[model samples]
Target: MEQSKTNQFNVLAEKPVGSLLMQYAIPAIVAMAASSVYNIIDGIFIGQGVGAEAIMGLALTGPLMSLTAAFGAMVGVGAATLMSVKLGQKDYGTAQKILGNVVIMNLTLGIVLGLLLLVFINPILRFFGASDVTLPYARNFMSIILVGNVVTHMYLGLNALLRSTNRPQKAMCATIGTVVLNCILAPIFIFVLGWGIRGAATATIMAQMIMLTWQLRLFSNKDELIHLNRSIIKLDVKIVKESLLVGLPQFLINLCACLVAAMMTRSLTTYGGDMAVGAFGICNRFILFIVMVVIGLNQGMQPIAGYNFGARRYDRVLGVLNKALIFGSVITLTGFVIGVFFPTPFVSVFAKDSPQLIKMSAHALSCMVMMFPIVGIQIVSTAFFQSIGYAPKSIFLSLTRQLIFLVPAIFILPHLYADPLEGLWHAAPVADGLASVLAITLLVLQVKKFKKQMQAPVENMHTPL
Candidate 1:
């Protein structure tokens, strides 16, 4: 166990930046890519086997899913960031406390949120602008998903916690396992079982359940440094408070996502109706895939930056941030190029038979990611703050994109343009550009602050006789 801790420290604290990043980021990217693929896989099967309206129903559930993820992030990301810093400080006891808190928090939030949503499912869907044709589909899928919400939360939270403990490979394996299981079950359940949209949702929760079981086993091992303990399982006020503080930024970011999705659906439904809503769903899936790739890079950066910062190794933290920015930018640029130039093929993958939906999605894809190249820097900067425990700064940056800028633009832009649908598509890039600029300014200031801190001399104290 000590050797394991030493190796983690050595790799995170001493390895060459480029090599260490590749080692961590590759697995993360694969895991994130696979996770994103599972989302797409559901869409593909639903669109191919079910109908466009079915996809729209799935789309309506975006806000609900985002809401669930928001709380899960609140627990998972919070605890994970805290754990990384604790590990760096060699406070193994606190790290174990965080692990216990994670399980409890996830279980509590999952049950509460799931039940609340299920109880109010219909009214919520109606408020989100779900038409009569799509309401049943949304309810069907969400009902099953809600039933297994605790499983979903536990899996996601544990995965993040695992990565923070320098178990990125293990985290990657869990997600990949879920993805593979999802792929197998989705087809069988949807097509062979003739269960339709509900089958897709069922497959999803089942896959998560299986992998979460595996994750629990890993944490239950007595040999691990941050393994589960019965005594630690009870809540600790300080651990809970700290975890929530660090996680608030991401929680709010996802909360904003839920709002933004709802707003887009409402606007799209108002102007373009069901097909338009479906088109946005396809576009969202593709965009999420790209974003997840960048997130994978950020995940790789998080532990390194968090640990080094805790250890007062400012140079290492800065090094990882710069490298992460470059790699993330390259990934986003690739996404932009593909989304702008070859969107039809991608959109076609989801809506092969629905030409109108394809056309709308293609246009939405291009417009939404117009500022894609700059986004890597923006996302990385926010993540950097979160990783280093600058929760307030991270929260501010996250809000700049989703709430402060995008929310207003999404509402105002459509009204300004003749074609409201085009305006809706345009709102994203507008927010992206504005938010990226703000992120750049903040990041520059942060870098300067880091430099000042690095140059400051350490205080010396003398003992008096």
Candidate 2:
């Protein structure tokens, strides 16, 4: 039994850094893809079930949803990275302590946030550009989503912890189970049950609830090193500080996206109407899916980098980074090609016969994906900085893309062109280009610092890797 337990850790950990990275990435990719299915399913069914108007309503709320996710990713991922390093160093006690802190933190976040969101849902949706036609739909959807916040946060946040433990298969299982449950229940809620917009949100919540149960069961069953204990809920100020130090950068990153997205939505509604909002929704959803590909690589790299860093195998971090960059570039290029060449169908795959939505979405698609390659670089760099505990660098790199670049583009690009119609569209590509430039810049600086540090003459050799 002792040997079996040892073999288990070695399973994901023992492989060459290259193969192990891919092994880790594929499961993460699948889980993310499956998660995207929830969006796709909701969009397709909502577009057909109610109408394009309702689709726009649903779309209007995307930014807030994405905003909340930033917290989950921040806390969950930050804690996971910390835990993985501890686990690798054989400090299971510290690892479990961090794990406990993460669960408590995420749980507290969801409840406080859910209540706050419930109180402010209307004003928030309005700020996001909800129109008279779309307001009801957005309200219904956002209400259910806020009410279901616990499932969404706990399910996803815990999965990151699970991933850090090297249980990618279990991680994959929980994610897939959620998607499967959503698939079965969504259509029923949307049509058969006559729940409409609320139904889509309900189905998604149910799926997440199911996934959370399965994930909880895994920890309870055995063979797991880091399990959440009832006594672990006491807030350790040190652990909280550490988790915030680790997670805040990620939180700010997503928060920036939310801010930019809100600007986009409000502008789209003001200048274009429900149609533009719907189109941008599809554009944002597609981009989210594309980002997932990069995020998967980050997920794969997180554990490897953290583990090897803990083991004092700094060379392995470089190895993982190299592989991640190459793989991420390929995925980004493929997504860009698909977005540029086949954008019409990409929109139509999720949308129905609405010509206005199709046209607007196609336009949004071409411009939205303009920075696909930058997205890949940004994700990898964020993971690299996080893995090495350069939390400030990670946070800054993550923020500059959307906050510094995208926000400026949103305002400046609209005015740069004389035509008012140009106001709405120019932000997409301009922001993409600017964000990409920022991401690449940060990445280069990090690389330079890393090289200079490692290249310095040492007792052994002076080479980095």
Candidate 3:
């Protein structure tokens, strides 16, 4: 068993960087792409089968969903990053402890956050710009989603551990399975059963619940190096702190995203009404598909970068970062081409009967992705810092686009334009451009520091902020 575990992790340190990236990244990209497809499909079903109001209502739920995901990412991303470093250091015992702590933390946080959101869901939806017509749909969908929040958290957290433990394929399979199941269930519940918006939420939760059960069984196998054990299942204060600390940047990013979504929705609702909100929803789903690909690439890079950095393999770390940035840029640039030049076909899929909705969505989609060619650098740089456990740098980079640059742009830009809606559409690209410039500056400096450190003796070398 020990030999098998050693062989599994040894590849991280020994494999060629290009092949290793392909081996890890392809599965992750497929999984994230599949998940995004499900979201897009869900939007299609709701818009076509229900109404435009329903689509707007769904958009209103984005803020709360982001808020829920924030906590889940905090534990999952943090523990997984930490676990990779521990494995590279050959500290098997600590890695096992991390696996145990992840399960406990996710369960506790999930239940607590779910209940609090459910209790005040009504006011929350209203604050997110849900109107009389849209409020009921949003409320119904979130009620079911919140009730099954623990399932979502456990599924995501366990999947992250699976990737970090040299089982990226298994993690990918789990996500794909859930997405396929949701795709099948959604149509039946929404169209056949006439459950409406509530049905879509139910389908989502049920799929995640089924997959969460499978994930639990996988972790229960004692043969695995990082399997769950009753003895180590108790929470350790130190592990919890480190995990949350490492995960804080992602937490803030998502939390700030929640705030940004709320403000954007409010502005859209005030200026352009419910159809405008629906247009924003359509644009968001499309952009998310492209962004998920970049995130998947980063996920593939995380273990490699973290493991190599822990082993003091500066060259390997630099290699993976460069590859990731290049691939991420290519992916986002493709999105830019498609969104700007040919958005009609994609936007029309959701609301074919509503010509106004399609036109509005197509324009919004183009404006939002105007600077997407450079957006990947910002995302990849933030993830690079996070993977290496440089929490302060990661947190600052994460906040730059969402909180510092985007928030102000969203507020002030609209007032400056003759058409407030046009200003809102342009805010995203402005933030994207400014954030990417900062990312490039920081990355260049970091690379220079790494080069200087490479000249020193290995034993005396230390990671500096």
Candidate 4:
């Protein structure tokens, strides 16, 4: 398909949204899954080479990393949502203003937050459940991530706009470049140079720099649609407000996930030990990977949903959601089943000589995989709610799995069991199961309402005159 003109309104109007969406989604999904390789590589290299403590060491930074990344994603998703709606409405000038504001906001925010992180990282790590043994490794790793936070922020935040513009392959290429670079450099730094945790962080920064460089090149291309002209390069109050309306729901969701990671860290440390934290860290990484399929659908459908709704094409939105939900269900079945029935193979991929990590990870991964289908439904439903501007519904559905359901379980489950540590391991999966049920119920009701509205008889023009 040829690209549309920068100011064109007929882009989506010319084709079925599903047709355009499929062209974009396959690559977007691949991009996210490829990006997951970065984590998998980091785990394999560090877990095997530096030992289980290395996994715990890096895991120490997971929540804080999540918090910072959540803010970055919030800005990106908010801006992209607004931009897509504007594009759908054929308001090119307003769309440009939004593009400018997103760039300004994310970069400025990234720099400010990065500096603060650099200053207080050690203190934050201790607060996140780091022990004397894990402190050095965590601090070194975090300090490096903070130093390059700006690059990571821009690459991720700006990449959202690429997808919103229906340029999925470009987005995928950007991620591929970074992950490939990271994979190559990680082993060199970790084993060849003997840099340990610091090496992993350094390797990540190296990859991020490559990604950032590629992203900047895209903005500079003169032939591009929606090129960043200097005239519209300032914040617009109206666009910012609208963007926040869509974006804040997702922002809150990510922020809640960060809270979940933090709370998991604190609780795992108390009931289990460094080993449990290590196991939890490994479990969560795989969880994120498994969920990426549903995430791919949510992300791919978000712009399509928002755009279709903006164009008042209500039925198109419903159609997109239908296909996406079915796809998400299939992906959930594949990833979760493998993690459940064949835990040894999956964990063995990231495992080394640590029998403790293997046992603990197998136990944790099996429990976590139990709720996969439900969580898949929750993920897609939350995305649907956010895409359609049901912000409160989105926020509630987003937080329930992690915060409302999981956190409370973490607190109460341990007390009920003879082995409190087993309760600790059960927190996330238990929450996932309950939350999935609630999400499914709400989704079915909402879909029925949409159907009712769609099929409601039009008022007879000349009835009973």
> Quick one: best TM-score, which candidate?
3
**Cα RMSD (Å) per model?**
2.9, 2.8, 1.0, 4.0
Q: Each prediction's TM-score against the native?
A: 0.97, 0.93, 0.99, 0.93
**Residues 1-465 of candidate 1: C-alpha lDDT, one tens digit per residue:** 587755656578888878888888888899999999889888999999998889988889998889889999999988888888888777888888889899999999999999988999999998888999999999999999999999999999999988888789999999999999999999999999999999999999999999999999999988777789798898999999999999999999999999888988998999999888888889889889999999999888888888888777788888998999999999889989999999999889787888888888898898888999998899889998999999988999988899889989889988899998888898889988998899889999989988877887644211110
Error of 2 at 420 (Å): 3.4
Model 3 C-alpha lDDT per residue in residues 1-465, reported as the tens digit of each score: 688867789999999987898788888999999999999999999988898889989999999999999999999999999998888888889999998899899999999999999999999999999999999999999999999998899999999998899888999999999999999999999999999999999999999999999999999998888888898899999889989999999999899999999999999999999988899999999999999999999999999999988888888999999999999999999999999999999999988888999999999999999999999999999999999989998999889889999999999999999999999999999999999999999999999988877887888876421
In the predicted model 4, the residue pairs found to clash are none
Displacement of residue 350 (Cα, Å) in model 1 is 1.5
List where candidate 1 sits over 4 angstroms from the true fold: 1-7, 459-465
Rank the models by lDDT, top first: 3, 1, 2, 4
Candidate 2's C-alpha runs over 4 A off are 1-7, 10-14, 421-423, 451-465
Q: TM-score ranking from best to worst?
A: 3, 1, 2, 4
lDDT (C-alpha, whole model) for all candidates: 0.89, 0.79, 0.93, 0.78
Show pairs that collide, candidate 2.
none
Candidate with the greatest lDDT versus the true structure? 3
Which is better, 3 or 4, measured by TM-score? 3
Give the TM-score (vs. native) of candidate 4.
0.93
Per residue, candidate 2 scores C-alpha lDDT tens digits across 1-465 of: 645654555544467899899888899988888887677877888988888878889888888987888878778877887877776677777777887787788898988888898999989998998888899999999899899887788888889988888888788888888888888998999899999989989998988887788888876655565676776667778767777777777888778878888988887776677888888888777777877867887888888988876665556767888889888877887888888888998799666677777987887788767767656776787777887667887887777777777777777766767854456676766666665667678777766765665666554322111
